[model samples]
Target: MMNTWITASAVAVIAGVTGFFAVLRGSTFAAHAIPNGAFAGAAGASLLGINVIWGLAVFAVAGALGIGALGRRARHDVVTALALVLMLGLGALFVSVSTEYADETYSLLFGEVFGVSGAEVLPIAGLGIASIAVIGAVFRRLMLASAMPEVADARGVSTRSLEVYFLVVMALATSMTVPVVGALLMFSLMIGPAAAARSFTGRPGLAMALSVAIALVTVWAGIALSYRTNWPLGFYVGVMGAGFFLLGRCWAAVRQRRAVASPLPVLPNESGYLPGLIALPCRRPCCAGRSAVPAVLLCRPLCPARASAQPAAPAAPDNFPQKTAAGLLMARRGESSVCDDETSDVWPQLWPGSRRTRCDGFRLHRRR
Candidate 1:
């Protein structure tokens, strides 16, 4: 049982991380296909009395390379068709062969909880660690390349090499998990935890961490339950992993909704330009007048004379918007003096006296 726990933990960790990368690469279906193809190879290896892990790993690497070669053309239909043929045809072939190992065959097919040994756990753990190391070494590069492959190519990032590297890591990791988790349940082990993590956290590192946590919990919990109740371990783990995803999404949605509806303090320089408006310097990050922001917040009522009469604070940089926090638009040196009615109508609505006045649809107005 202890050995089984270690092996399962190793498999779950590999699956969780690789699955995240699979989703990131838009290769979720490919993740599915590789395992199915590997299972076929494993069955064939069993028939020939060859090493099962080696057979599956070799085939998985080849399948991953093939999928990578197909690249953009590896569509959903293609992946599904290939996976179906590999899974069913190999199972049928394995069944037709006479074997003293009928129980072993079924165990490999559906998986067996008690089958994992202490000897097996170390190697699988090594495989998982190696896979994670590869991912870690190239994570930043992968993220950059993935975000803009064309740009990355232009910048000499070798997008093809990175793709091949990721595919290889994915193949190794997926194969490593097969014996412990079974081909059918492997994709769930990979995709579910990562998805749950993503749903809960926007930060990539935190998301992956959460995925590993979820995987560990589900795998261990499933093991405990399976041991006690004699239920199918794979089925339980898969279901729990899926449950985590749904729960994370729900939690994230609730949090986002609360944030969107909650009113908070805003900055005045957030507005771009109202016909009678000007941009202001907002001292707050929470205020809207950030550089590159389309809209800015401003003071609603314009009282330039009053504003001028009031004590002056430290002047912001010359590049700062000429609007005051109270919504008075200040004239810039050697700039256009014309103010139009069209600009006045476009500001955002604020308190009773304050409305979004448009300065080229960029300025905002705040109440005094």
Candidate 2:
């Protein structure tokens, strides 16, 4: 039981960390397929009378390279699916031909966490450490590549090389985790906790911490529950991981709703420019004598009472028609020449003591 706990926890940590990048890189399907491919390696190892771990490592690394090569031509999901189907077919063939210890193959497909011994612990820990070190070394490059490949490429980062390196690291981690979690449930550990953590937080560091914590808790609790209830450990782990993901989705939904209800403040600079109130160049002849008055005033809404209080002014002649805000031309006597009712009062405020006359349009009148 102690050995089982140690192995499961170590595998959980590796999967949690690797899964963060898997989700970030949108290579979750590849994460799933790699473990199953490694499972095929285990089957082949059994048939060939070799150490299963070596077989798992070889096949996983090969599959990673194969996927990377294929990804250059096709979509990632398509490449991953092709690899997954091919590996599953190979695993089925290897299993069919092997007659001895057929029941043991079931254990490999599911898991044998309780069967883990002290001898296996050192290797598992070493592999887990190696995986973590590799991830740490390429963390920045991986993040830059995942977020914006074009930008990373422009900045002299070899995105393709980084991608292949990342995939190789994931392959190694998958190989180590398969024996403990089973190839079938390996993706659950690799994707579920990290996906849930991502939903709960936008910050990458905090999300990674949450992912590791969630995976640890899920593994420990699953082992305890399986021990007490006499159920399969994989079943408990899968259920717990899926439940956490659903809970995270619910939390994220609540946050989105709250954000929509109370949006962030919009600064003056952020506000859209008003199309009706454009500041034109001040070069009109009408504005020559008056420096205080602008050349063109795109009038907005003004007080209605001010519009009514102002004395009526004579309109311009037929030859010199004035354009109003409403696109109407006024050529009548003693009628307001302003186009829109909203800006009618504002024009009087701008041109104080200026009256519309028949001879000179609007001339400024001096107070007697």
Candidate 3:
């Protein structure tokens, strides 16, 4: 039982780190392919009466290097498709021919941590430690490359070599984890926490830290739940991880909404009447297509027809068609920068037909 906990922990940590790089670099499908390739290799080894670990590691590494040879973006989907086909096809073939060890093969696919012994745990533990160290040493470079690949390359970082290195590390981690968590579940362990963490923070470092913490908790909780309820450990771990990710997304969304709703200070010399812009808490539905602003306002009170008859005059700073004032207002409120395109929509709705006269050629309008 203790061995079960240790093995699960090792698998979780290895997977979490690999997943962090995978998601960061947008190589998730490539990382996923390694385990599928390993499945094919493990099945083939079983048919030949060989060590399944050797087969899994051999094939997974081959697949990783093959992807590296093919180039990163172009061959990613192709490699994943091939891996899936090989895994399922070889798995079926192995089952049909091996009547004697059918249960053992299935156990290998989904995992049997209860069968892990102290001796078997040592090798996997070593692999896990080595993977963690390599990940740490390359952490900054990987994050830099992931977020800004072109900038990183311009600054003398070898993006291609780093990609290859990341894939190799991912393959090794996948190979080590397959026997403990199975191919299908291994990827969930790898990607779920990282994905969940992303929902909580835009900062990659914070997300990675959150991912590692989530992985640890899920592993321990899965073991405890499985032991108490006689459930499969991998299934429980996956469920808990997914649930955590959903919770993170919900939390992030709530924070974003709050940020948007908070009041912001208007800049001096900025006019109160921002032109043709939509205000917050608007009922108007926004979409890809154009929609007319049914109502409009100008600081001046005049009859609708007179307002329409008057020459389209330069409007107040905020009331102008120019998006600068609204952008500044949003920035002062501590929210994410609002896109000019969105401000464009709001501008027409709020000011109507104001034009900018003197202020850096910014145009403003009042409702016609």
The numbered model that scores best in TM-score is: 2
> Per-residue lDDT tens digits of candidate 1, residues 102-161?
565555545775787777778888988988898999886776455335434544789888
> Tens-digit lDDT track for model 2 on 135-243?
8897767765675454456547898989999998999887766776687666788788998988777656677788989999998998899899989888988898899
Cα lDDT tens digits for candidate 3, 245-325: 798768765654444211112222223222212221111111100111111122221122222434342233343322233
On lDDT, the candidate that comes out on top is: 2
Error of 3 at 253 (Å): 0.6
| Candidate that beats the other on lDDT, 2 or 3, i.e. the better one | 2
For candidate 1, what is the TM-score?
0.67
lDDT of each: 0.62, 0.67, 0.63
Model 2 scores worst on lDDT over the 10 consecutive residues at 286-295
Q: Predictions ranked by lDDT, top down?
A: 2, 3, 1
Give lDDT: candidate 3, residue 272: 28
Model 3: weakest 10-residue lDDT segment is 284-293
Model 1: worst 10 consecutive residues (lDDT sum): 286-295
**lDDT score for residue 227 of model 3:** 84
Q: How far is candidate 3 from the true structure (C-alpha RMSD, Å)?
A: 11.7
Candidate 2's error at 134, in angstroms? Answer: 0.5
lDDT for 50 in candidate 3 is 96
